[model samples]
Target: MMTHTETRSAVLSIGRVYCDLIFTGLDHLPVLGRELFASGMEIAAGGGAFIAAAHMAHAGRKVALAARIGMDSLSAGVEAQLRESGVDLRFVEHAGDAGPQITVAAVVGQDRAFLTRRAGPALPATLDAALDWEEACHLHIAEYATLHEIPDLVSRAKEKGLTVSLDPSWDATLIYDRGLLRACEGVDLFLPNLEEAEAITGSADPQVAIRKLSLAFPLVVLKGGAEGAWVMSSGRMLHAPAETVPVIDTTGAGDAFNAGFINAWLNGASEEMCLRAGIRFGSLAVQAAGGARLLTTAE
Candidate 1:
């Protein structure tokens, strides 16, 4: 049974969670016959949902993670971190098929590459309960893949009277899907990286891609690495420059930005302020090797 709350202050974040193995400071990517050495490595609880939720919680926003994780050894490896992330985990479903989801990230210079494996269904059993939680007025879908897996999620959340946001996390297979706009029909906010926007809109021009996207989504925020971010809404386009910071690893920087932007937007911040907040969070993300590193020292 879900109980109603007076304040709609919490955010419900839905997506998959993974145990991330991050390697930073590599000279180059690994070749077929050659093994590359990295200067540093860290194992952390990751995934678009977890990373963004962690940051949101770190920023003093109440967040609930509604996703699935495995009940396996790999899941055990990240249990401690997840428990300490400060994001509510009551909605996380632990099942045999959900275990062993993993992402291996290799960072060389300012660029990074990832190899990932996803197991089980993306939807969690507690999804409906999480959505019905009275404290949550907003729903953040961490990845387009999750939206694809649960096509009616946006409408379902909207039916519950919660505003919805979606991040089109880069997926080689789904980036070019012609049905993307349709799948995101009821999303209030659409966040995408420059590459994703270009791929989806089939245009190298960021402005053109964003303009086209704005026609579908009420708000469009495009994350541009190094070049900052762009926002399109209500027939207006806004741009914010990213801060130049020392680069360590860029594994989940975009997701961190999503947290900052979403949090501010939910709080009624101006468009420019939201972009600035996102840039601030993203700057902190690249200063460390892992996505949730700031939270380790947040308090």
Candidate 2:
């Protein structure tokens, strides 16, 4: 078992933690203006940053979360779960603006489409914010295009001599098309899906795309859902295949993969080890109901 205060390195996760409202084993999508029966429903505290950092925390690292939540019950509940998961909540902020977004999905196995309400825009956690960048071994930002666009936070973290890992949310589609490709300069590890990688590079073949992406950064892990994940760095490409499992809900599978991959790398594992560990953890995610659910069940 791994504890939160293990002495490997420091990890800071700055991004989101929202209530993932998931419906599983659904017969079919509901027709227009009609109701359909769901086999079961489960609510879990999940988001790209939350689940990723939580798993890393469980894997023995000093982890802190930099996030903003509204003054609502669900928001408070999400915070409570993070505390239980052993993530340091010192950077967790409460704003009076919009509540945390709720992602609703009709998930069965390894894929689902989520619906989110348009709340007010999320603010950035710039260098002027309350984060203590000097007290950590590494820092990460997740799905924060709005914040990184400022160009201040990334440079500041680099100035502080902190290694950075970044996960771009779907907003990359909007940001990448508009001259945002060079944003990869400051990031150490670039995590993106196959589709996003293609969009970022305009490459029809993702295998060729990963090689080009790694030239700018030390590593690039193009996450493919069923094909596992592929990594390219220093002119070498490695592939990690996924395990066959009875998938219940795959809402957070990719997030789990990021957690497993980064945690191994932070612990001084080789790039090859990181990719395999990531795929191993992600395979566990599918067998469970939610992203974080696999943590308690991991051997």
Give lDDT per model, in order: 0.89, 0.73
Over 4 Å off, model 2:
1-8, 118-121, 124-134, 144-150, 172-176, 297-299
Top candidate on TM-score is: 1
TM-score of 1: 0.96
lDDT by residue for model 2 over 183-271, one digit each (tens)? 65688888888877787777857798888778777888989888878988778898888777778888878878888888888777778
Residue 126 lDDT in candidate 1:
97
Could you tell me which residue pairs clash in candidate 2?
Answer: none
Clashes (backbone N, CA, C under 3 Å), per candidate, total 2, 0
